[model samples]
Target chain A: MEIDYSNIRVIGFDADDTLWVNETYFREAEEKVGMLLSHFETPNKIDQELFRMEIKNLPTYGYGIKGFVLSMVELSIELSNGTVSNKIISEILRIGKDMIDKPVQLLDGVEEVLISLSKDYKLILATKGDLLDQERKLEKSGLNQYFHHIEVLSEKQEANYQKLLNHLDINPTEFLMIGNSLKSDILPLINIGAKAIHVPFHTTWQHEKVERNATNGLNYKTVKSLREILNFFKQN
Target chain B: MEIDYSNIRVIGFDADDTLWVNETYFREAEEKVGMLLSHFETPNKIDQELFRMEIKNLPTYGYGIKGFVLSMVELSIELSNGTVSNKIISEILRIGKDMIDKPVQLLDGVEEVLISLSKDYKLILATKGDLLDQERKLEKSGLNQYFHHIEVLSEKQEANYQKLLNHLDINPTEFLMIGNSLKSDILPLINIGAKAIHVPFHTTWQHEKVERNATNGLNYKTVKSLREILNFFKQN
Candidate 1:
């Protein structure tokens, strides 16, 4: 897809895996959880069951590490028939705590790109998840100085992007969104008449993975990393 | 403290406990948690320990039912010396889940007050805590129609209030905040030169309770209930 950067004014960036290491930690947590529940079921079966539980509980739990931890705990009881040992349950919790404590490790060239872009465009952090967790990560990221505003959305969808654009008094054609997930970060913005650039994260969650249909008319560019975005704007 | 509503252009409300039942649920959940841990320690001791754990975990959990549940789970292990049974743990989880599923019971005259004030003045729902939970409650409460804007703040300090007012482009003197917490809803706005009205909730969370010192000169009003706020504007 051909992309133009001349009209773009406010640039929005997705925080999670797009900005720093996020889904990798979730995968690590799941691996640890599968091992902990190995006594009750095979690791492969546990992974499948956990994925099923997460999909079922998304409406109730929403997204983020807190919800992920709750699903793991609930799955333990269901798998063990309410007979899971306290030691294993505690271990599961320990895994969650460790994930939360993990530092916000920014990906390669994130800061330099943000710095270069902020001079020319208004940058806003638009990400979905638990409010407190996201706020904490943003603070710890020490990249708050670059962005003009931070919007922690409940979910990223077509209506959500439209609402944000309307609230910000932004023209969709003049706005650009960069993120990892096509289902969340790309398709919705494209549907709303905004331009989106997909910066694929190394580890994508199963839920976020989507099959692109040939019939869809969404126009977007998939870059290897954030550093490559600088190539799109000569001034940057 | 004397309050003059004559110049007010917008009236802001604190959602939890002020417009609806919130702190009461926390109290109820705490009681259930203390009971579940009674076998491990004295109920009084368990209550004290839980409070300690909650305060300690506030930085990590922030303020929400999800954080409260995680604290309960953590405290259970400490109180029972890791001997807490899965049955009791599951019970604790159920207590938290029930709190989330509970109905949004708006306090007396909340809707009427909103409807009345919204006509004469722009009404805004300015509350703090979990963003998703707050959004859900607002949707379920049928109160969203009356609010010009609903802000779910992470914290309600003077700076946050200032930023909100600036975002809405309202003068401090032309705004009035009515809510149940002196620390969160009232004092901060007063400090920022905004008019405030304190409507005390029947149950105040310990974290929100603050001693009123007679030193500060900021003026505000304390209404008995939401219904009385209508009386502030004589034309209503």
Candidate 2:
């Protein structure tokens, strides 16, 4: 699918997976917890049990250290036959806390692509995560300078996308949503009559990935990587 | 600050941290990647290197896995002096893939609060994230049942909140934004004369935490948990 970048005045980008290393860190931590859980229960069971607790706690606690800490505590308690040790809880907390303090990494060709795109498109950083963590990552990553606007949101609902379009004073048809998650990035944009480019990342967070129906080809297109975006513009 | 739940004709929620365990997983994954980098250089040096890469990549990649995978590969190459092994790359990929598979965990009291609130207010799930991920999480977490309208968005700018109020056919003052992030959930709502109850989460993602001042006292109030919302409504 070809896109006319000239017509696209504002281009919005998803921050966590699109711009830098995000899910890998979470994956590694889950694996660590999974490994520990294996000592008591099967991996599948451990995941199921932990997931139940996570879902139950999400409304009140939310993502990040608080959520992770709660999950670990619950998992430890469950695995230890309701006898969670302080040592185990402490270790998990330490590991969880240590996770966010890690370094931010950029994807391949990100700079080249952003630089190339920014020359024409009004670049915006649209990401959904904890407010402070996302900003720190951006500041630390040094990517904060390139964006004309930075939006750190809670979830990527249609209203949020529409709000972004409204704030930019651009028509939905004139905006393009670019990111990896079909659930958060592409679908909402498509629903709102905006153009969307789905650059599929190899690893999607379990909750983020969606089953796609290739039959409906309307406002959305999926590309393999960021480099494909340039070609999309050139072709259109 | 107190609020009257009985007067709340409509209630909206912020997803991600508000509804589930999101950041901790990302944080954990980041820590692991950082540790891996430390094997090649000092923690601080690795952090600086990764930060530079992340900043450079934001415009090209938006958020989630694509950015993360690219960052990991870049980090591996940099740390390995451009001779990063396939094994290490595979390791990174493995970690990234694991994150996508982790189940969606909702926060504690989410169901209870939503169930109670849904009884009185026109419940809407106003969240921002990757569309597919948020939807799947809602479906799997079994919380989608409570919400009459579910909006997945890219960002929660003021316009989006206003649009939501318009869509719901409710006065801005009649709407309530309940969630963890003060930046996205509270500030935007407050900007438009809507009431917001901030349920502070321990680990706020970098991007979602915005700087608030004394001037932000008009339409916003911070609470410790979701359960306290009932009391807020009664007092007001």
Candidate 3:
């Protein structure tokens, strides 16, 4: 069955890995955390525990560098039986600050694609990251002009996308989503009867990794690069 | 000169402390932190230092219970000379979770005012707190039905208000803002040539305090409670 692009009046681009370097920094931060806690546990063990801690606190902290850092601090204290040195906790805080301060690194063809598509369709940034951090990155990325709306969601479930569409005053068929995370940006839209395009990033967070069968029969495009998306929207 | 709200077509309400009891919880949390860190500093001294630390970290953390918790943790480490017990840190983490889990306590006459105004004008929640936290509170408050939109802003400055008006596609004169903070909800709207009504909350955060001279010549009205504003909007 041929999928349709003619109905998509608005396109929501996920900010983090889809537009620029995000998960990479998180990966680096995790590695640094692993090193920081190596005295108590193995690097692999530390990584697993940190993931567990974040998931445990997801309802309380939602998603962001601050939450991630807090989880790391908590994990350090837990792993060391409430005796983790304050130096390690301080370093974790520094790691989070550094992540927030990191330069916005736009991915290949992001600007070009946005420029081309934004001329025809309304472009919005819909991400579940912290609002300030995402807004700061958007301003720093120098691509703020390309967007019409910026939505920072607490979660990107089917209901959230529905609320977003209603807020936008658009139908599901008239909206399309694009991002690297299958769990967050793609499947949720597809489930909600909207369109989605998957542009896989090199590194995926453990929580975002989905089983192969989850997308087995879902109808969406998988482009290797963002630039390739232009071909689908080019009117004949 | 009498202020005219006859031109108002949309109403924006500040969430924290405006619709519900917010700052009171923050104050209580501060007292808890002071008690927790009493060994390191006097209660007054700890309060002062924590405020200083929060101001220093505001740019990084923005606003919310999560940021508040993070600041408490950082302050603990700082005040103890990196010798704070992990138990205290864990307790701080518990404090954050409890804050997030706190029930939404609506201010007197909030629902009555919302019900009356929402019938005549489009209503929106314009807040600077965490998006998740604000959304959760709104859901719990049972006042979500009265709002047409929920906007969690990074900051409620003049430019942000200007952007909001633009987004709402309404002229400044056609919008009215009602809230508890002079620095945030009241002054910014007045500066942008929009209508604003100040309903002062019992407790205001130190950072949100405005100098008397700042509002010396401003023309916004000040109401003693949320319910009083209904009198201004009722048809003659």
> TM-score, each model?
0.94, 0.51, 0.98
Binned by DockQ into CAPRI classes (incorrect, acceptable, medium, high), candidate 1 is medium
Poorly placed runs, candidate 1 (over 4 Å): B214-216
What lDDT does the true structure give each of the candidates?
0.87, 0.71, 0.92
Candidate 2 local lDDT, A119-213, one digit each (tens):
88889999876545676688788876678767765568898788677757899888988898888888888888888888777788767766667
> Model 2: residues >4 Å from true position, as ranges?
B1-236
Prediction 2: B-chain TM-score: 0.86
Docking class of 3: high
Model 1 global lDDT (CA atoms, 0 to 1)? 0.87
Candidate maximizing DockQ: 3
Whose TM-score is greatest here? 3
Which numbered prediction scores highest in lDDT against the true structure? 3
True contacts kept of each: 0.42, 0.00, 0.78
Tell me how far the alpha carbon of residue B173 in candidate 1 is from the true structure, in angstroms, after superposition.
Answer: 2.8
The digit string of per-residue lDDT tens for model 1 on B12-69 reads: 9999989899988998899988888888889889888888999998877778888788
Predictions' DockQ, in order: 0.61, 0.03, 0.84
